[model samples]
Target: MEYISFARLIEAVYLPQIIYTVIALTLSCMSSHRSSTSTELLTAATVQVSSDNQSPNSGNPENTYSDIISSSVHNITVIGVYMVIFAIAGNLMCSYFSGDACTIISTYLEIGGGVPVLYSMDISTKIKTALILSLTAFGGLSALFQSRDMIRISGLSFIKYTTGKIVCAFLCFIFYMMCL
Candidate 1:
């Protein structure tokens, strides 16, 4: 009886897992190309904002900042870098205007990611899996390329991060197989 119930539970979740796995693999492959473009975008933002010594007269501040944030492209290679950089820029700008950086960043992530929002539960788990893979792959490739500081993830070293990614990817495939 116990074994039969466990089998049924697995069967119920299997198809979604397989779909998630395929999506995760595809996202990982896309992330490789995004890493390079992301690096470039990060570099541009750092140059424009990080230097306190730059003269305010060099260009209109709005243009300088807007250039960093306005990207509508959705290709993983382009949109990945664009959204990350734009989010940082948005947070940085909010801090500059509101005088509270940490609060702004936290709020932005919460609102943008629906992190604490219950509605996020309905979001596709496959997307969550894809995001994890993309982020892990991007961070690993960035470190290998010597831009470790550009993408800072807390609490996990690169090896651990990559290991977790692999485990998740495997589970995603297993989930699919179980469903099939």
Candidate 2:
């Protein structure tokens, strides 16, 4: 028998996820900066030419801030698509590998990944991911999907689950609005 190290297991299980996250975060930052710079330069130049008799100084500053916000929002949308893709991959990985922890972690990451997608806002990724994970674990413990209990642990019922899901959903909405 061979020993599979925990680090190696984590890598094998989470490698694609980790890589996707790093790329998503890095690309969001880079894209926002690049787009902001390019948009500002181009917008300013256009404003200068078009508003020859108008206040170029006023237009420049406003457009600069707007450019940053717009670019950040654009990057977040792109990252959202990436997040969904990773979630799909994680779901498929769980299907094939049959590892409970890996499957659970993958789904949790799916929601956690949303933070960066909404990163232009104030919510931290840790908060987003943790919220998702906690809700998911709470659901599983309550047996949201009875068939999914390949390794059955007791003390769960449907009423308990419905209640938890409702509470979690409300909490998610509250946090979402706070981010907004």
Candidate 3:
């Protein structure tokens, strides 16, 4: 899906933050907190609200919003902090080198760093584009670890995820070459 690519397109520093929010929301919605039991609890809560002359879900907007926010805050904060650290570290590492070495190191460190480096390098545009595409498709090592950490309990294997990235990166590389 396009969103999956968006997830790996770490070029946008805020992409991971948004992705983490969506992921947390999705996981929370799929969680026991959102089960039929929650509906039943809501029904009981609604009855209590009705007795007090209030609507079901509409009466206590603050309560619902606060609950959602509180439940998702911890995970989102942790992931956001991690990403900030990632970006800072990548920038710091890139500061040590210039030219192609910087490009190579940054690309290896994070896909986000690769795009600018790819553009700044003295290489042919076609090669730069292909490499950038490959970096986005492969998502570098940081994304792999981030995704693995996020989905560790989802029954998806890291090997499969990495294989998928490789396949996608290879396909993108081929496509870029053909188009050029």
Candidate 4:
């Protein structure tokens, strides 16, 4: 049995994820047609609150804060519910397939299946690694659904979403080839 070190796993897996997250965020910000104006309101409120202890809402600022916090919590809960349902349904659909087909289905649902599938394959480790990396780059159907739900309020088109996924997958394959 091959024993992989923790550092190797971090270097190969965690570091790539961090890099991908940074790149994804940079791309998202660059691609957005309109930037959020909400930050201006928050900055103004912070300046005002800091400038005066005698502010009119000094006694009720906590109430306002609590309202914001409560709303954020509610939004998180709703999103969590949606993700759970999506994962459950995807897993159920994947359960019907076996061997490589099962691996592909599970990977389509989430990237978590990639490692197991890679291990199960009789192919060379290098190819297995590439497959896992490619699967991660695809971001799975579950991720696509989540993205759709999140962007529902932003008027993002389905065509754009699919195009982005295709571009990402292509980049991932290139990255895998470079690594190999």
- lDDT for each candidate structure: 0.43, 0.48, 0.63, 0.60
- In model 3, which regions exceed 4 Å deviation? 1-67, 95-102
Maximum-lDDT candidate: 3
lDDT of 1 by residue, 87-139 (tens): 56655655667543343233323224322322233435544333333333233
TM-score of each: 0.24, 0.28, 0.52, 0.53
lDDT of 4 at 59: 78
| Runs with alpha carbons beyond 4 Å of true place in candidate 1 | 1-63, 66-150, 153-156
Candidate 3 per-residue C-alpha lDDT over 1-180 given as tens digits, one digit per residue, 9 for 90 to 100: 012244433433233334545765587588875666657756765666567444376558897787678758966776566566666777787777656766565675566656686767777766676677777767876677667754544434578667666666766666656643
RMSD of 2: 20.8
| CA deviation > 4 Å runs, candidate 2 | 1-62, 112-180
Q: Which candidate achieves the best TM-score against the true structure?
A: 4
| lDDT (Cα) of model 1 | 0.43
How far residue 138's Cα lies from its native spot in candidate 1, in Å, is: 11
Residue-wise C-alpha lDDT for candidate 4, range 52-114, written one tens digit per residue:
446466579797687779868977786576567656766676676566666555655654544
C-alpha lDDT of residue 152 in model 4: 46
Q: CA lDDT of 153 in candidate 2?
A: 25
